[model samples]
Target: MRLEHDLAVRREARDIIADDVAIGVGDGWQHLVGRALVTIRDVTDGKVNARQIKERQGLLSIFTDIMIRGSETIAQRVFDVTNGAADQSAWVCEMCGCGGRLIAGNRLRVRCQVCEADEPERERVWREHRDDILEAAATYIRVCLEHSRLFPVYNIVIRVCLDDRDHRLFLDEVHDRLVWWRAGSWIEGVEDALRQDFRRLDFAR
Candidate 1:
């Protein structure tokens, strides 16, 4: 969900959700989650505790471990409500909350017709421009590493010995880029390209 929406739900259901718990969902299921939390709260009379709220296998997954001041029947009802909400999310778009269908493949996603339709074009564009995007990423990372401006946030794993000089330099450069910097106007363009590349790359599988 969006930060604002997440914050709103957290604020509204302060007593039910843990402080560190993250609602791992998109804007589309905001109401479903909000309603579920509210219903759970009302049903348990402000005595339930939710430890996790996330999307699991393209469906809503809410994990609640405690319900104080509730009978066995009430507890069962709570479970039914949570499960029902999760099941309902199967048809709800995770991005826009519109009616959606689960797209089964390498990764599961619940997306509406519009969002699903856009995926192919995104993948097509990424595939056509793959080399350019990769070169930009490499240039950005190399520049950042050489100038000690910043480190790459994403990478492919490397198998290097602990005492390798190249590995040590890579680690040192990575550590130095943790702080904010005026990386450059070019940084924005490179970052945007990299984001698009990374997002569309998942569809290739």
Candidate 2:
């Protein structure tokens, strides 16, 4: 298989395993075992039978081991799988509420700290530069669309207060331009985004 194909398969497998781990965590081990059996049957096209339970048991054990080693590993694997698929990480400042490198030097402060300290002055400047707020909103939308594979879009829409019509429009626009070109297929990224709940891929929200 090609590298992309392999990565895609890994991503799918990881997602499936993650779901199983979640079920196992939420319900009981017996429920996990039952779900595993169902999953094996589904994956194997009903070829898995009573005799295969032992093998499935072993598979489950290995999966649990890998999962227990680190939860973040699975998360990072998903991140790696979707890396470079979108531009999602860029962010504006919180304290100063400025875009493009709000902090300077080693201080890591949002503002220069030398200027705009007074509350009234800060509010006045922010109000005068309302365009910056709009720009930030646009950038936020762009990032949300770009990194949507990391979370589900439905959740994102809810979290971001985007209406269904606007959400679909955003998806269609991104699908037509950036997503299609990058994935070499219109549906792959869209489908993945839908499957992953449109998690933002660029950066943690």
Which candidate wins on lDDT? 1
Candidate 2 lDDT over residue span 1-205, tens digit each = 1112222332434333332122111001222234443444344444323221111211122122323343464434433322311111112222222432233443332232322243245344345544433343334345566655333323333222145443433332322233222333233223433323322243333
lDDT per residue, candidate 1, 1-205, as tens digits? 4334565677678778764566777768888888898889888887878877878988988888655557898789789989999889999998778999999977788999976765565455455544444444455455544454432333422423244543433332222221111111133334533333322121111
Q: Please give the lDDT score at residue 165 for candidate 1.
A: 40
Cα lDDT, all candidates: 0.61, 0.31
Clashes of 2: 13
Sliding window of 10 residues with minimal summed lDDT for model 2: 19-28
Q: How close is candidate 2 to the true structure, as a TM-score?
A: 0.19
Query: In angstroms, how far off is 114's CA in candidate 2?
Result: 7.3
lDDT of model number 2 = 0.31
Compute each candidate's TM-score over C-alphas. Answer: 0.56, 0.19
